[model samples]
Target: MSAPATAAQPSTFSRFLAPVLLVAAMWVIQFVDAVLPLSFTGFGLRSWDLQGLLGIVLGPLLHANWAHLIANTGPLLVLGCLVAVEGAVRFWTVTAFAAVIGGLGTWLFNAPGTLTVGASVLVFGYFGYVVLRVFSPARLAHRLLYAAIALIVIVLYGGAMLGGVFDAAAGVSWQAHLFGAIGGGLAALGGRRRAVSA
Candidate 1:
């Protein structure tokens, strides 16, 4: 008797679909924001406001303007795809960690009434995950490969990541960047434990 056919793995393009669709959604939302009479930015994370708590879920999906979204698109796609390469679940898990932790941290730390919005939180989160994954418990070969990838990611984004957290200009929220990175690192370490137990 012939063996049952094996399940086909997803295509490389399919693996990347999540981030692409996320960027597309950002663009579409920006278009709608521009054409409509309403301001979506108001829905973003507001410090010390009870109603603003919803921004933890909505803030990353909104942007200040086309410039803000444009600035975030490249890094989001690059770092997002890096995380997605593991699988869509990992990608979204990292995203949720970054959004919730980063948003809460920003809300708690930013001056009262300060409004924060953008995908930069996730960008920094992905950056953190990629770098910290190097230390995840794994086979030596896998750890080495992760080390190489982490090195490359650091070379590419280290300066910007540092600036995002430590040298942000007026009106920028460094708290979000710092806490987003913390969230990603936590996800990486948490995943390490899971992998060991599995």
Candidate 2:
């Protein structure tokens, strides 16, 4: 008799592909911008400009320079992979929440005509999601596991995350960091509700 089939397993690569693709897109766009005469930063979110509202969707995909993209790359990959541990859907959901909320907050609060671009918003969002996920509804064992992971994340990124929101220097958008974090927290809470209801 043939052995019964076992369930397929998710590969390590598939789990982390989303963040890799995002960073790759940013790099590719930056390359094109560097090679061409045209500038893409103009497409970044501009405070209080009606036409600039489109930046909400495009801003994180663009960056001010190679240095800016490099700075955001590590954190985005690390925290994004952590969030993606839940699944690709969950990963995209948190990203959407962070981008929209972070973008809107930046648009409303920054100086008019001020332009913002970078993946720092998503970086902050993923950080918040990882930290707050400990509070999400789950079985005791699962909650403990999440708590352990959250503690480690906090220890690693806590100081930088705080500085990002409260000690932002000139040219940095603290509003995006703060609101992106709020978006992440909301996603965590939303997960709790879904778990409880189920």
Candidates' lDDT values, in order?
Answer: 0.90, 0.90
In the range 88-166, model 2's lDDT, one tens digit per residue, is: 8899999999999989999999999999999989999898888889888788898899899989989999999999888
Question: Cα deviation of 44 in candidate 2 (Å)?
Answer: 0.7
TM-score of each: 0.95, 0.94
- List candidate 1 segments past 4 Å from native: 1-8
Error of 1 at 104 (Å): 1.0
> Candidate 1, residues 51-142: lDDT per residue as tens digits?
99898888888999999999999999999999998888889999999888888999999899999999888898899899999988888999
Candidate 2 Cα errors over 4 Å, as ranges: 1-9
Pairs that collide in candidate 2 are none
Residue pairs in steric clash, candidate 1? none
Candidate 1: C-alpha lDDT: 0.90
Local error of candidate 1 at residue 98 (angstroms): 0.6
